[model samples]
Target: MDIREYRESDWNQVWTIIEKVFRAGETYAFSPEISELEARNVWIEMPKKTYVAIADDDEILGTYYIKPNQPDLGSHVCNCGYIVSESARGKGVASRLCKHSQQVAVELGFRAMQYNLVVSTNEGAIRLWIKLGFEVVGILPNAYKSKSAGYVDALVMYKELKT
Candidate 1:
């Protein structure tokens, strides 16, 4: 699989996954009825960088976006969000994208990485993140209304990069 910078042509596939995840209301805080243009601005334009994980045939399997946790004084600590294609889940697609994103973050001169809103019910992601060396720095109570889990907490995870 290839994890590389996102291209304009990648938006269609990326949007497919984004729409599904957002509509599911299981993780992201985005409204289920979020429109394409809004999604584009948030996922593409707002980020410092975006990436897609592709198969050998160039089929997009997963995607991630990295940006500043906050602008100016806090920009050195980067932030990220990820979504894996439905068919690609459980195959380590998200894991690879995450690991790759850290390197990319470092290359982009970020000194740390932070996941500001990891839904508490997403155990697989929390587990993988811990395995990758991120710590749960804080928990926002009743932060996300997950479809299946109802009102759930959100974890704020942080990882200091080696610079």
Candidate 2:
């Protein structure tokens, strides 16, 4: 598999991956009823950069986007969101995308990375982020309205990319 910059052609496949995750309402903060145009704006247009992980056969396995965590003075700290196709989970697609995102972050002159709303019930993602050197810097109680778990806690994860 390979990770590369997202192209306009990747939108349909990228949306398919994110749509299911958004509709699940279990991890990301996006509304379950988020529209395609809105998703495109958030996932593609708004971010500083977007990427896709492609299989050897050229299938889009996963995607991620990196952008400033906040405006102006906080722009040195970047934020990212990731999604792996159901068929690609457990195959390290998310992990690879994350690692790639960090490299790209540094290349883009970001000093750190942060994830503002990681649903606490998502153990796999938490574990992977920790393994990749992010820490749970803060927790918001009952912040995520999970489809299966009701209002669950959300975590704020952060990592200093530069010393």
Candidate 3:
């Protein structure tokens, strides 16, 4: 897979992925009925930069967004959220996106990356993140009200990007 910066033209395709991922109520914390306008704000407008992972023909198979974890005092640390199409899962898209996000964070001068509310029940993501060197720094009990399991814990994972 090839990772590249997102272009304005990519929003439609990116939304296709985002809609499916979010509506599934599995990975992200977004409401299933999240409007496109809100999605645009969250996935594109808010992020410092967004990326799309594509195939040779340039079909967007996965995507991620990176931004500062907080403004002002906490700006040195960044955060990222990722989504891989269901059809594209188990094919290394998430891994590639995470790696690309870390590299992009470094390029943007971020000292570390943190995932603030990773659902503990999301085993695949938890495993992938741990494999990518993120440590579980904290856990918020009953933080995520999963549609499937209701009130599951959320894990806070962090990785210092600079050496």
Candidate 4:
């Protein structure tokens, strides 16, 4: 998959993936009832930049957003969220997006990257993030009310992008 900065026309495809993930209450904490306008503002307008992982034919396989972890004094650290289309999960789409995000983050002048609410029960993601060099910096007990797993902890994963 090729990862690149998002385009205006990519919104529908990006929303399709995000809406399904959010509504499932599996990973993201966004309300299932979030409106299109709200989603546009959050996933598109709010971040420093957004990206899409596309296939050879240009079908969007996954998406991610990067932004400052905090405002003002804390803005040197960046944050990101990723979502891969279900059909594209095992194909390394997330891996590509994540690696690409770091490069973009550094290019954008961010010194580190953080993921504030990674659901603990999601072993695959946790493993991948660890493999990608993110450490479990903190854990919020019973943080995410996963639909299937009930109340699960959320992990704060972080990685330094530069020495």
Q: Cα miss at 129, model 1 (Å)?
A: 0.5
Best by lDDT: 2
- For each candidate in the order shown, give its overall lDDT on alpha carbons: 0.94, 0.95, 0.93, 0.92
lDDT of 4: 0.92
Residue pairs that clash (backbone atoms under 3 angstroms), model 3: none
Q: What range of 10 consecutive residues in model 2 has the weakest lDDT sum?
A: 154-163
lDDT of 2 by residue, 1-163 (tens): 9999999999889999999999999998889999999999999999999999999898999999999999999999999999999998998888899999999999999999999999999999999999999999999999999999999999999999963
TM-scores of all predicted structures? 0.97, 0.98, 0.97, 0.97
lDDT of 2 at 18: 95
Across 1-163, the per-residue lDDT of candidate 4 in tens digits comes to: 6888999999999999998988888898888778888988999999999999999999999999999999999999999989999889988888889999999999999999999999998899999999999999999999999988899999999999973
Off by over 4 Å in 3: none
As a whole number from 0 to 100, the lDDT of residue 155 in candidate 3 is 97
- What tens-digit string does per-residue lDDT give for candidate 3 at 89-124? 999999999998998899999999999999999999
lDDT of 1 at 157: 99
Ranking by lDDT: 2, 1, 3, 4
Report the C-alpha lDDT of model 1 over 78-144, residue by residue, as the tens digit.
9999999989999999889989999999999999999999999999999999999999999999988
